[model samples]
Each structure stands twice: as C-alpha cells, then as structure tokens.
Target: MTPHSVTLDLGGRTALVTGAASGIGRACALRLAAAGAKVRAVDRDAEGLAALERAAPDAVETVRLDLTDLAAAEQAAAGVDVLVNNAGLQVVRPLEEFPPDAFRLVLTVMLEAPFRLIRGALPHMYGQEWGRVVNISSVHGLRASAYKAAYVAAKHGLEGLSKVTALEGAAHGVTSNCVSPAYVRTPLVERQIADQARLHGIPEERVVTDVMLTDSAVKRMVEPEEVAEAVAYLCAPQSSVITGSSLPLDGGWTAH
Candidate 1:
C-alpha cells in the first residue's frame, strides 16, 4: 500500500463550517476552498456570510443558521464530508455575577450544538465511509481563567466530545480532532477584552498582556490562518490515523 501526500487536496469534496462569517471559521472556509472543497459557509450573521460568499464566489455557498437550533444544524450537515464546529460565544464575569441564561446560551452553542451536529452527521459519514470532524476549541479548554466559567466549561466539554467521536468513528473511516488556539485578533476576542477591562478595572492593553497572553510563551496571538492550516492538515488523505487528538495552536500557552 502507498501513502497519500501530506498536503490536502479536497477537490470535489464538500465541507460545512459553522461560524464561517468571521474569525477562525472564516479563515478555515477560505483555506478549505483554496484546497478545492465546496464549502457550505454558515453563520448567524447574514451580512458576514454574504461577505464570505463574495470573497469566494465560486467555491462557497452561504447558509444563514443558528447552531442553537439543532434541527437547522442537522439540515446544514447533510451531504458534507467535513464538519467544522466553530460557532461559539464568550462571556466574562465573576461566577457569582454570571447570568443563568447567558451561561446556558454559551453552553448550548459551544458544546451542545457541536454534539448535535456530530450525531446528526454520523450516519451520513458512516454510510460514505469517509469523513472528518474538526472542533475549534480554545486554550481555556486545556487550562482555566478567571471570569470565564461558561466558555471554559463548554470548550472543555467540546474537547471531550471530540475524543469520543474519534473513538466511535474509527472503524467507519471517520476521524475527529480539535484545534485549540490561543486568543486571536477576532471580534469575539475584542469583545472579551472590553468586558474583561470593565470587570477587572484594568486597561484594555492589560487584558491582552496580563489575561490573554499571560500564559503564552510566544508573546503573540495565534493567527486564524495558522489554525486553518491545521484543519487542512487533518482533512488530508493521509491524516486518517490522527484522530482522538487535541492539537494546540496556542502560541505555547500550555507549555508552562
């Protein structure tokens, strides 16, 4: 038997990326499109999804969706070879001050939605005998931070769910893995910065330095494209044996 090339060539394949409107999800959609995948780019933001469609008009199909709607998520997953569970939200506040509804909202989107999508996509992938699942977790998934109980707990659960999916999908030729990244320059992170500053009574600059980047040995935020490259790698023909893994693209945030 011969091994396939390390580089991904997704020509003729279809990929569905949640949260494809901006940030890491947008980057992953672009990269997968560049690798020849037919991308179903999904997000709650219609305008953002339209922008993504404009940027890759030929390769992308925009789908407006709220992952919190499990039926809609399942409908979106149909006929896709790759699933990128990237839709997420962040809320930073002291545990005692966290709103109950806000906590549930974050957990629902970040953890429950991904789980539902994976379950919905399983039979399709199993029937096809080839599939890939990429869950975009966070540095908080592997570690902890103050004022981020919901985000951290959801990410942690997502990582665990990915591992279980990997185990179950092994015999069916499907693989599941997570790409955990450090803070990136995205709208979500920017919002977190403002919230953290207000909560801690610190300058926004310090939020980046003392909060997000405090554990990162590299002293820089992870690039969205860098995380996308890892997604491309896992989608390659040769990465069949790479399931049940959480690959950190976190600027060495966990090294300490």
Candidate 2:
C-alpha cells in the first residue's frame, strides 16, 4: 500500500510512546516526531531503541523501560502532552493451559500499565487543559478468537478504561481513545505465526492464510503506518470532540 502523508503542528508538544522499539509503536513515534513533536520512545529493548535513535537523531529520545515496572512506566509518562500505550506481549494457549504468571504479566503490561501511565499523565494534562491518551488496542478488544484468552481479556479491559478516561478527562481538555487494529505485519504477529500453527495443527504458511486472515475482509494485513495515521488523526486539534471512541483498523473483521 502507498504511504500517505501526516500533517499536524505539534511543534512544541512532548509525546511519550511505549513499545517504541519496533512495529506499530516505532511507526507512531516517527510519525509524531515528523509532525514536530519531541518524542520519548520507551521500550525494554535497548538495541531496538538505539536503532530508533539512529532513525531520527534529534526528534527521538529513547528510554529503556519494561512496563512490568509499573511505577517507572507511570513516571516516564509524567508531563508528556501525548501518551501512546502500545507495548504488549502475547501467549497463544487455551484458557486452562495458559500460564498463570504469563496471564498476570500480560494484564500488567497491557492493562495496568496504561492505567498507571494515564493516572500519572492526567494531572499534567489537567494543569495545561490539554492532553491526548491513545491506547493501541486490538480487534480482540471487541471480538474474540480461540487460544487468545489473555490478550482478548486485556484488550477488553483497555477499551473500558479508555471510555472511563474519556468521560473523566472531557472537562479537563484531555481526550482518551483507542486505536484497535487487526493483525499487522509486525514482529509480534510474526512470532504468533508459529504459536498459532502449533495450536491449530497447521503449517506456519497456513496459519497466516487460513486462521489469521480468515475473517479479514480486506484479505491483507494492516500496515503499521496505517495504524500510526489513525493515532495521529485522533491527536489532531479538530479531534477534540472525538473522545470516548474506539476506532477500528480491523479490515472489517468485526463486521462479521
């Protein structure tokens, strides 16, 4: 797909993006920085963060953080004008077989960390009378598939959290919304291929063609830039009235 341009004047804004090491988070960090925002790129992957620094020497500042460290995650979000909660991990297993620790970790990073980050960021936003909290939710937030119990649960929780934030933040000039997407061409998705195949008893190629894309009407994976563009749209000045919404980039997957 052809890449489209993003136009926004975030000249003096400070944006913090979690999971900024690669994939969708990386795309969003670059996109916002291109619009003139000073971006704090957060991820536990020091090497990936280093690559991001090389990609945009002056626009990005890299912070190595594991969202499991909830306090530090919250601290990193303080005083930022924009917060993008995009860090996530996945484990493909049935509910009963899902590891307990993995479940806790998933909820910690994908759900609790966002809550803490928002909690930390809201005060500064309220003081300034403006802020944008964009959670990188998933198609699973609205729909569910087998062998993804933890992921789906966390996303559903995130969706509810985003709505509540929107309501509380409305009067404070802060808007919280979610950008939910279907499978994208990212490292996370690529890794899931083997897991999905293992569980589904199919080859890796078949996992992509049969199980993964089964419900995607568009018949192709969404692009990271595409998701980044949607995030940018929600952050636009005109989007002030567009709070409490979950914009789906699911290729009509939920249409069914």
Candidate 3:
C-alpha cells in the first residue's frame, strides 16, 4: 500500500519464483522482474499466470505445473541464479481427524518439493559460485496454532531444511534463508479465516480481530508487497552476509 523505496539491480540474474501467479508469490515475481532479473514465474494456475505475464512490461516466462510432481518441480529450477520456494497449501484439521493423504501432500509440496528444488539448484549454483535460496515461511514456522497440525509440521520441517541448505551452501556462495511472515492478506490465509472461526467457535467477523491478530501487536494482516519487499532485500547484493537466518515479518508476534 505504501511506496516502494529500496532499489535492487538484478539485471543479469535469472530468478525462479515458485507459486508466482498469486499473492506474495505474484508480488515477488513482479518485484524481481522490476529489478531486472529474468524471472521464470512458476505456478499451476494457468489463468493467473497469463494475467501476470499480460500485465508485465517485459516478458515473464511462466511454468504451469503442480509442485507435487517432484521430478517436474526439480527440473523447473534448473540453471537459475535465484530460487524462491513459495508454493504451499494448508489443510485445517485436528491431528486425530486430519486426513493422512492431505498431510503427506502438504509435506510433499512444502518440504520435499523445496528439497528437490534445492537439489536441482545447488549444482548450478556451486558451479557458478553464486545463488540465492529464499523460502517463504510463516510465523507458524516459529510458533504454533492448534488445529493446523499438517501446516505447522511442514513449516517446521521447512525451517530446518532452510538452515541445512544455508550450512551446505555457505562454502559454495549459495545462501539460503527464510522470510517468515505473520498472516498476510493472501488467498491461503483467506481460506482459513472461516475454518479458524469454526474451530474456535467464534463468529466469522471475530476471527480476524480476536484470533488472527491476538498475538500480533500491529493487529493488521501483512500486505503481500511487504513480504515481497523482504524477499527482494534478501536477494540483493547487500544481503550477502545474511544466510541461514529466519527473517521475521511477524508484526511483532515473535517479539512475545
């Protein structure tokens, strides 16, 4: 909503952004492209990808494929200078009632997919001696909420994966980090609003104020652009020394 002040020049770099068709992914795609990177926008949503490419001034190449196809997901990241793993889905249910298939898919997409993508990306990065791996995580990554067993588990695993990537990539000039944000105004979070309300036995209207913002000192959902800005900053030249770190965009939730 506010003006973007920071400037980044990634003119010659090739950036691959997963889930690039919407929300924070869309914003990150646009931001990186604006910084002059040859961005390969990956998403399963063809319609959304088309809209994104049409709206851009330059050509934004899009890969339309589901990340659950692990081999394809890995292949999609080949030869990119920057990788942003942002594709994820959430299933809200108590652990006892959670569907086993849903949990497996969640872990497959969020955790395993990132692993394969990193596996696909590292050789190229190590060969070139430069790369950036930015994972879009959430405050739930650092904390926890009830009735989100699968989502929380996957994020926690992702946090670990990101750190390990950072350690292994350090000597190779490949820095891996996570941008952990609180609730953002995105489709994923929007879908959960009602679920949260029902689980907590609160009216839908109260979900946003009382539940979502309970630990958030700011009491407002984060804008996708704000999260994108952090992503941009992490990939910038100045952030060379910052790696294996969890950058919190939590609206003060983690400050507790």
Candidate 4:
C-alpha cells in the first residue's frame, strides 16, 4: 500500500496503551481513538488519565494503575486486541555510577512489565485469531551511548521480546513489532536533558546535540505524531505481513 493509503478503520478493535497520560503514549492513544478503536488509556497519573478521558470521552476509557505491579499489568491487558507497550523510564548514569536499585527499576518498568502484559494478553488475542503488539523501543536499542546503560539494555531486551513474540504469534495472526525513535520532545526527554546536564556537568544545549541528536542526520527531535503514525501503520490490516521488525522513526539516526 502507498503511504497515502494508510487509514484507520479500527472501529471494532479495542486498544490498550500504557503510559497514555502524555508524550508518545498520549499521542498513540489519541490516534488510535481517532481511528475508531475503543482505547483504554492506562497511566499511574490519575489526573492526567482523567484529562485524557475528558478530552476524548467518546473514544477512550481511563485506567489508572501502576504497571510496576505485575498483577495490575496483567489485569490491564486482559481483553485487549492491541497492546502498545509505551510505558518506560530512563536513567542516564555511567555504568560505574549506575545504582543497582535504579537499574532494576528501569528494567522492571520497561522490559518486565511489557513482557507480562504481552503474555497476559496473548490468550485473548489467540482465541480471537488476531492481535498487534507495538513496543515503543528507542534508537538506543539498536545502537549505544554512554551513561544510559539501564535504559539502553531494557530497550534492547524489549526488541528481543518483540521478536520472540512475533515468531510465536505469527501463526496465530498476532503481529509483534517495535517502533524505535530518536529523541522526541516529551516530558520524559525534557527530564532526561536536565538529568544528563547535571550528571555530566554540561550545558543543557549540548545535551540536546551532543547526546540526543548526536547521530540524527535530521538534527531535530521527532514529533509524537510521527511516531504514532508508524504505530497506526503497524496496527493496520496491511501490516499482517510485517512482524518481528523494528521500524525506525529516528530521523536517520540509525541510517548512519
């Protein structure tokens, strides 16, 4: 299909997006809703989830839960046709300085929770003979950088999980793929900038260029909608044949 042929006809589908209160998750929730999917927007922030429900009352259902709770994550995935694993945290510290506790926290949230959610949701999708799993991995998953060991490791593990899920689910018509993006202007990225500057003793300006956009040929932060567009494509009907892949919305960051 041509780029223009991509359209959302998810009227009968049910989508569950974690971390839907803001940034890429929020954008994905809204895009899925606009495309006619009944979206369950999950986030730990009750106020933000409420705001999303208010903004798209007709299109979304709000679920406020901390995904770190394995049971809660599993419950959240139950009965969903599409699972967008977009909830994650970042910790930018040199491996030598990285706290064990902090590393575990990042891994649990980014990798462990998604793995549980996918496993929990699989039976539902398998029974129906259709499903989609969109993991919001990062460009760092493919490459590497200094002072981001935990985040990079979790993302890389997520890609592997996506591949395994794709291979197993392929026969059942449940496609699994990941969208790897460069830095996007999200609250998460904004926080990363401040944290990196303080950790590395560099100017905030340098953080954006020397770190976030260092490898991007486009030299600009990606937009949430740009990433959401890719998610929509993966969730679409035509993407049935597209599985076990990492689609880059990286502004050519990985092209080099």
What digit string (tens of lDDT, one per residue) describes model 4 on residues 1-256?
5433358688989999999999999999999998899999989999889889988999999999888898889988998999999998888888898999999999999999999999889999999999999999999889888889999999999999999999999999999999999898899999988888888789988999887787899989999888899999999888899999999888898888
- In terms of lDDT, which candidate is strongest? 2
Model 1: colliding residue pairs: none
lDDT of 1 by residue, 7-27 (tens): 788998899999999999999
Output the better candidate (2/4) by lDDT.
2
Give the total clashing residue pairs for model 1.
0
Task: For residues 1-256, write the lDDT of model 2, one tens digit per residue.
Answer: 5354546779999999999999999999999998899999999999999999999999999999989999998899999999999999999998899999999999999999999999999999999999999999999999999999889999999999999999999999999999999998999999999889989999888998899889989989999999999999999988889999999999999899
Off by more than 4 A, model 3: none
For every model shown, the clashing-pair count is 0, 0, 0, 0
Candidate scoring better on lDDT of 2 and 3: 2
Worst 10 residues of 2 by lDDT: 1-10
* lDDT of candidate model 4 versus the reference: 0.92
What lDDT would each prediction earn against the true structure?
A: 0.91, 0.94, 0.92, 0.92
TM-score winner between 1 and 2, please give it: 2
